[model samples]
Target: MTPPEAALDTRGTKPPAVLSCPQITTLRHRADFLRAARALRQGTQGMLVQARCRRDNDPTIRVGYTCSKKIGNAVTRNRAKRRLRSVAAEVLTEKARPGWDYVLVGRPGVTVNRDYTDLLGDLNYALRKLHAGQDQ
Candidate 1:
């Protein structure tokens, strides 16, 4: 059977896919996450965002997404992460600042069920607060 993407109609009804997630570097090491955790935190209804300005001048934006077991079982966690990835692809590409590392943590109940537009708004608000030159 043909894949869903390949089975698209000639009428062009299908919307575009998510951004492939390569525009920004990914934060892999535990240290990178720990450091961002120490930097700045902004919480929204859907997710918690941690942002940190990197010391180096690389000008590469880095991002990480995580859903703890508290969020749910493996499948649930994976779903939450997928949604987070999709939202990040939309918001981070433009709103996220260069030379920064950000971690998006999924909340237990809300992350999985929250409306997608609200989720996007949550990330945008968190980013704005972090960059508003607050106490930091």
Candidate 2:
């Protein structure tokens, strides 16, 4: 029965990680997603990866994640996307090429059920094939 402002002390609680990884720029525009879709794409057992060079001289790596309704209802789709984001953070931060945009498309059943390590392997392999000859 205390005042509303005085009753709250949840500052240290673990909230959902919204800006957990700051090094990787997140892609939010539909145009960017479409541009990446028109570019190179590689698929693995866990997910589908689409990548494109922006050619705009920006050293930032931008990425987007998507989950279709085919994955399931809202909860399932979100679960798949969350997994995709987690895997992306682990792999893209090190392996993704700068000045590029990437879109990670979640699979219907594979994304949420696949083992985390295997998901990492899938992303690494897809990236290797996507950026095969461009590396220096």
Candidate 3:
């Protein structure tokens, strides 16, 4: 047999992301939580969303994304969360306010062939809905 060849292993298993959308709670609220509650939330989306009223001193919000094993195997779940994280960084970087913690949970249909713009739009819409509830 010849020496092993080196190439981009597209077939290689994808790795889980280092960033995760951690569950937000009142006790966990620190000085640096970024306030995306008003923006990253949308009740109409029919997704589970919980928020804390406390504020933090950090200038940027900490965000995490989760995909349960039900979504698929380790690879599928990791891919979904990674996509969410990339979109979060691209669109929510400057958009999300400081002092709040945000997390996004993937729905069954969330992993479809959707574009980043569509994801961002959904996020924006949800955020508006969340803020509307705050007004009432």
Best by TM-score: 2
Provide the global lDDT of candidate 2 against the true structure. 0.90
> Which model, 1 or 3, shows the larger TM-score?
1
Score candidate 2 by TM-score against the native.
0.82
Clashes of 3: 17
Question: Of the pair 1 and 3, which is ahead by lDDT?
Answer: 1
Those runs of model 3 whose alpha carbons end farther than 4 Å from true positions after fitting are 1-53, 133-136
lDDT of 2 by residue, 4-120 (tens): 755655776654446533257999999999999999999999999999998987788899999999999999999999999999888998888878899999999889999999999
lDDT tens digits, residue span 58-124, model 3 = 4445565666777788877777777766766665554554555566666655553466677767676
Q: Estimate every model's Cα lDDT from 0 to 1.
A: 0.90, 0.90, 0.54
What is the C-alpha lDDT profile of model 1 across 6-71, one tens digit per residue? Answer: 786888677677764335878899999999989999999999999998878776789999889999
TM-score of 3: 0.57
Worst lDDT run of 10 residues, candidate 2, spans: 14-23
TM-scores, all models, native as reference: 0.81, 0.82, 0.57
